[model samples]
Target: MRSIKPTHLRRRAFPRYLSTTTSAQPHIVPITSLLIANRGEIALRIHKTAERLGIKTTTLYTDPDASSQHASCSPHSVGLGAADGYLDGERIVKLAKQHGIQALHPGYGFLSENSAFAKRCEQEGVVFIGPPAQAMADMGDKARSKEIMTEAGVPCVPGYHGGEQGEAELLEHAKLIQFPVLLKSVRGGGGKGMRIVMEEGEFLQQLKSARAEARASFGEGGEVMLVEKYIVRPRHVEVQVFADKHGNCVALGERDCSVQRRHQKILEESPAPDLDNVTRLELWEKARTAALAVGYVGAGTVEFIFDKDTGDFYFMEMNTRLQVEHPVSEMVTGTDLVEWQFRVAAGERLPLTQKEIIERIQERGAAIEARIYAENPERGFLPDSGKLVHLRTPRVSEDIRIDAGFVEGDTVTEAYDGMIAKLIVRGQDRETAIRRMELALRDYEVVGLSTNIEFLKRLCRSPAFIAGDVETGFIEKWKEELFDPVVVNPEVFVQAALGVFTSHITKDAEPHGESLGFGTNSSERRFLFKSLDVLDPKGGEEVEVSITQKGNNLFDARILRKDEKAQVFENLVSSSAFAAGKTGLTTFFPHTRIETTVIEDPNNDNKLTVFQTGAKTELSLISPAWYERALGLKELRASVAAPMPCKILKNEVKEGDRVTKGAPLVVIESMKMETVIRSPQDGVIKKLAHKEGDKCKAGTILVVFEEEEGAATAR
Candidate 1:
């Protein structure tokens, strides 16, 4: 096996391809140029397929994403400022018309599912690279789509899809459906405006909460709510369907997206594991029927909720556009869905029949994709945004691939989703696919902000996940193993000490950029660092790492932790830090050495983020008389702080309101999700820093609690 090298990550520029072969059949109005009306990884995904097909492409980017690779890598691009925005279909269509673009591809978010936007594109003589407006309109509403599915002979979950959505009317239906009912908005997707009521007593509160969120997310279209029986112990499976101008529709394959957090998928794999041939055939038949009934002409996904124990399934909803996990299906089927979209919109026939697609899928192997997001899984999966100081991803090969829109030094703003990239791998079978995914995740590294990489690694290693036993509640079921308690490993301190020692030694040593400098230490070097972060910086357990110079780049290093054994390690090579790069180092521990990256926070030298085996560990370098350090450490136990940068939607409490533990204090909306800030304990509100509609950064105090009898409360 070849050792991988880390570098600044970026997608290479693609040239316009020219094919030599001629078409065998005639096609009308072939798309010569296209405008991608989206941003981030999805935009780049479309661009790559278009480039390979010899089609000209244009992309749009807002001010916040000026440096994004998706916008810069395009052959042609138009920059939209903060005011213009990606949601303005009129502006995008006008730009398309002005540039002589033949078609416009709305890549999955923003305006992809907007039926009105698709109609606008048609009226302006620009082909919309998606299904017809009628198809999107019918399936965009959950209630109406359920009725259509039932009429088309597709099995749907039992629900009340009537026009009457009054609070009293819905409450009566909840009783008819029994306890543990689901409240969903008429126009809902992406888990917004949806809530689960576990009992009859909690129906009304959950309804009101769901309604408020629905209205906020979908406007007037979300005013109506529907009631249905919530499926317990269910697995999420969706089938990929494609159609053309001809009267032929086929199911490409199926993917399992059961592993999720907060109702969004994090891991997905093709050829859903542990299912017999009979179930797969049934799954495909229903998915094809649902798409054909609505005249779906382009790419679409029909989602289903499958009973884990019975193999019975029911239609959940249908996505009118491409899904984020489409890559896995493509990997198994040997298809380029974006290219198919271009051909279908240009009045072409289906490339293959149903039997041909299924045969191809069977011949190919299994594939899995893991979504890499800029969020902290340990902190309730809160979205995080900041500049990526350092970023490295696994190299793409025959078995591994990476799709991304950001590179090193790019800023991840709160104006859009926090996805960094998608890591995909393929193998001969299910077990091989899982093993490949695990190794790929262990090779990915990131810095400057929190991410879910470590959590993803743990998920790939879980026994249940390995055995293909997974469902929607997999994370909650395996939380104990996924979120293991942080134990500062002794290897981390040794790696950090060597990195620090070599970083100063190599200030002018550029000859051995791949190895630590072979320079002699002028004097004894010592560093003061803390093993873990505490409320008081001065009153913390300090770790002492001492270095005594022996010769050129050779030294004796000792680590002394509070109330622990004193351990010592010496250099195996001339330099204590053996294999070293500008941002990485390998420290020898008597018998073995491991690669570690030492990154000093650009803003503060006292803050260090050490990467060991692709997992990040944070330690603070203690500087004496650090008045500034004390000021930055907030009283986390006495105040409720914002989890991330977001706008306050509402304040649920007054300045002097008394609240019990778990009481809602504030409601905030960020990254298209609503979260309620709750009281950590019983206390009275002493102050509120920001009011409703105010924008605040992460760690900004939203509510401060008064000390009651010397006991503190916070969130």
Candidate 2:
């Protein structure tokens, strides 16, 4: 194979990043043109590496991602023209051949781990930048993978890997394994198609639900599940392994992804905190053994469930592609894994042997990656989608990396994953890393949709986490502190009052007032302040305030509250970063100047969000609570609504049906994950607005409860 370095490749520094490089090998056919068969941040991430390596690339985008940044990053492009186009491997492979692209890089997710897709790429003579098709097929099946790992002398979770999946037979297996067993689908990944059966009575019900979700997510093949002994306190540790065709494989290092939500990792760090060097080396050896067992090649991750109590670890699963949290490993190791993938795919030998791979490590440091998602962490991490509207990211430097697929104004549709970006920070040690992460989260901002930024900030400062005590149940264990109600400062109320006001103060300030200006001395502006996570304003945590603006927009602000001293803020110097751009609103108060962005709610003129630093406080103009209650404002709080745009998988309740609090009323599927919407209280269903198979947007009422007679009589 003759090597060819095309001229279309431009040598550009990867935006404050430079990947490790290697000399050209004579036995390699340099892939001058590549096609990225993925979308979102991963796609953009790949494109960056490809460009840095002087390789021309092509990217694919679906209809929803047509306007996405990743779609336009590549000089060459293709449109899938459908929402689920990323999963259409056949079409992707054909497009690669049609575009004369020499290699196709499946940057995780979608068809990245699909063995059939890898085989198709091989058949088309297009280099697939991943493990061999056989490796993927061998490790793709969770049960089979366990069997192979056991044969390879790798410790695996003790469980039933047999074909008898009937509830009765599974129950027998569970009995042997004891209570609190894990029911995992053979085809499960990313927390789908799995459930925890804590006791015998709930075994069958959990099994049924798991099977249903598995069937929906992975088709009929997902119906087959294996039972395993559940680890009460487990730390999710995974090793990054790379292999080449010449029978060489090496472990980059291990990462602790114990902090997760819904079994999906949210925070990941390298050199897993508090791990002993001896066990760490063993982990790497075991990971390599597992990789070599399947004749693996390219980038792969060997996940293990580390028993915190016993110090024993078992193989959990193998992800046969680059991972989302790969950046942390890169930051700590100072070796570009993506560049290695490209090199290995081009038939080059491993850049460094096992000894060199270990020796090449720079000075010791720690790196952590925080995943920012368009989800409300307070509300069970429900998915949220909308236009980015406003986005301000932390500065990207040598130690700080922001990998995102969307910019301001781009929309986060419900057709795909809700992850917005990844904030990766590196420091001299774990303590430094945690501190930097907290500060980074403080500088990051996002509006127009709820995000997990605030939740992550709390986790960064969490005592348990700071002390290096991490487990899969960390979030739930620190639930109260992590979800503590945010106290809105009284000064923020002044900011809110100055941030937005009406035109008429005394039945009129002047019929013609500056649209952006505040009200007068008697403005009597009434606004309620609440954190974005508070789903309903009726929550007792919310604060109601009345502000009377005497001067310009926040020029002179006086705040008064019950039992609180009246504070006056004068000389409210203000400036905007961009002319008429929603990006900036800097206001200087008496004590300090705060960066604030006030975004008027598109759906409601009376509602607005004031973004301070990175925290966002939502304020809405409303009548007094008593008056609104008397007039029946916004519907009663006796309804069940879809947390996100989703397809109703099953309606478990009907009109006139009575349900107890927490009883399942409906199951809705969003992006292939199913969530059961339960009754908020014990009441009879007054109406069934949506049934099975209906698609509804977020906040769409699915069921309304009949008003209670006692409450009604009081009204």
Candidate 3:
């Protein structure tokens, strides 16, 4: 309800460009307050830049994100309903007007590329901090953009970008382009509404799925589709370009986004690795031409699919808005792109020329960015959504930058993308940057949900990645190494046990400020033996540990193996409780010091949650009697369940229908990806719970099966 104001307004120390023949410079629009039409990290990112420019920012939030970090980043926050609130253009423009917002910045998603929304802002007399509406319409559609690129002398991939909408006609074009062609929505971006048909037999099914996703994502413009040649093992690269209303355009540089999973980029770096000087220049030139052809007026990205083996690159599409990976480009160029966007939207000319931009890139060296997502890489990279019980980022440094959206206790719901944060690092060279990123990832920690942190670490250390041999299929090629189960070392478990024990003792002894003698010696107190059941992907291990005080904040800890021989391992270690309100313990050994985050179960104090090296280990301190009872319980039944909250698009079976193993039973859509739930065995459908168009939650059983007689059932 109250308007937000910047804490302080400081003039930026940048050169002011003078107008030609300065007889009172021409009128430039003044933007005092702006509204960011997006949410999460991007909203916070835009707000910070606006604050630095002495511009107040107003941010809109869905009901779930009403208390999110982004909402609090700006005091002028509006709570819109959960569903379709950010995407509602008219309401957003009205809110902007009510708050006296001079400009609107659509941060890289939602209505970022929607031309209608831009036109609406223009109609409302509010400046849109992006490209012109005409340019967005011309470049937002994949088919039209390819046509424009070809006219501008930019090489384009051979495909069908026709105006036909019939399924048969599109199928004919696919055949002409040959098998393994790509089906894409004309207005799609970020891998939505895109599918690859490897054979003719699977064309129609993929087309339907692609169309469904496109319709859900793009709405009105989703009716049209385009087909392209699916380049095998090509490098995904894009050039960042900026244009001013004065017709001056410059291409910053290229970012290699080849490492991907599910067609979405996970890693991106500036000054694409292994690119020849000649090829890089050509890429920049083509990108500039593409932007000029569209009369681009703000920040845009020209994406190209590059064949590394042949050094051939073709324009894929141009994103008519700021990209999510713009931070890496900024680090490599020593320029704040968001600031440029603000200035350009106010009808200001570019501060630097093409030559100056190139010089900055050369001086800044190399930079890399890794997107940290709350997803399970081993489970087909399926997105995970839940509350972040604990979150800790590495300390920010000159060379290291962390752009995060969520803090501790923030919930990662299924309403948006799974990305938690982006970790970017810069160095004097490429190898140094890679090593810095690895160390940064190891220092990053998040619990209460699955993440790809460990997977990113292995990827950075991969030999092929180090050699710069990357392609769009890099993750798929190295899936085995990247998805291998992590082996939690015994020392980590010991450290966790020590951390938990120390915290418990310190809490109990806080009131007296002295030892509570339960044993014969008053100074030396003995704690009961605590059995920790360590659970992992590999079975489980039970270790009985006991501690006795020896000196000030020093204790003798002993570990006994419950299985096989009663082997005893004893060591004298010094441990101390961390500060109040902190969730960790500090342990000092003879040669090493260990710091770990230890979370105890609120209901059961004996259980501990340890976050170590980006992986979570649940250690349940149990009694010998409870351990026996826990092991005797039977495991739950395996049923076909929804991986995430999604609407059932198709139901291929009914109750009592007998199905064979691997038969597709249902199709569900979530987060723009279609997952086909198939039968695990030949069995009769005992229960068909949901119908098409009905929404279901993750772990909700869609179909339950009763095994057929004499049929081999494998789960």
Q: How well is each residue in 1-715 modelled by candidate 3, as lDDT tens digits?
A: 1111112223333222212322443257868899999998999899998999999999999987877999899868998896579899999999999988899999999999999999999999999999989999999888888888877788888899988878899999999999889888998887888888999999998898889888888897785888888888799999999988776788888999999987889999988998866667767777888988887888999998987655678898999999999999999988889999988888777878877887898899999999999887766787878788667888889899988899998888877888999999999889999999998888877766678887898899998998899999898888777765555555555666566556655675421112355544643322222323222333446555455567776666555555545333344455555544235656665566666677665445556667665555666565445454446443334468886777898999988888888899998877656778788677888877898989988778888776445433232
Clashing residue pairs in candidate 2 (N, C-alpha, C atoms within 3 angstroms): none
Ranking under TM-score, best-scoring first? 2, 1, 3
The CA lDDT of each predicted structure is: 0.80, 0.80, 0.78
Displacement of residue 712 (Cα, Å) in model 3 is 13
lDDT of candidate 1 over 1-715, digit per residue (tens): 0111112223343211111122454366888798999999999999999988888999999998888888887878899889238988889999999999989999988889999999999999999999999999999888889889888888888778788878889989988988788888878877788898899888898888888888877777686888988888889999998877766688888999999987788999999998766677677778888988897888999999887765568998999999888889888888888888888888887777777776787788899999999998877888999888878788798778898988888988888878889988889898898898988887877877878888888898899999999999899999888877566677777667667667756665322111223345354566666754322334345677776667665667778887889987766342434232335765556777677777767766666778786567778766554423434443334888898999998899999999998899999988767889888788888898998899999878899888666445343
Q: How close is candidate 2 to the true structure, as a TM-score?
A: 0.89
What are the models' TM-scores? 0.89, 0.89, 0.87
Which lDDT tens digits does candidate 2 get at residues 214-270?
887777688999999999999999999888777777888899999998888999999
Stretches off by above 4 angstroms in model 2 are 1-26, 360-364, 502-555, 560-590, 623-627, 630-637, 709-715
Clashes of each: 0, 0, 0
lDDT of prediction 3: 0.78
Model 1, 43: alpha-carbon shift in Å? 0.9
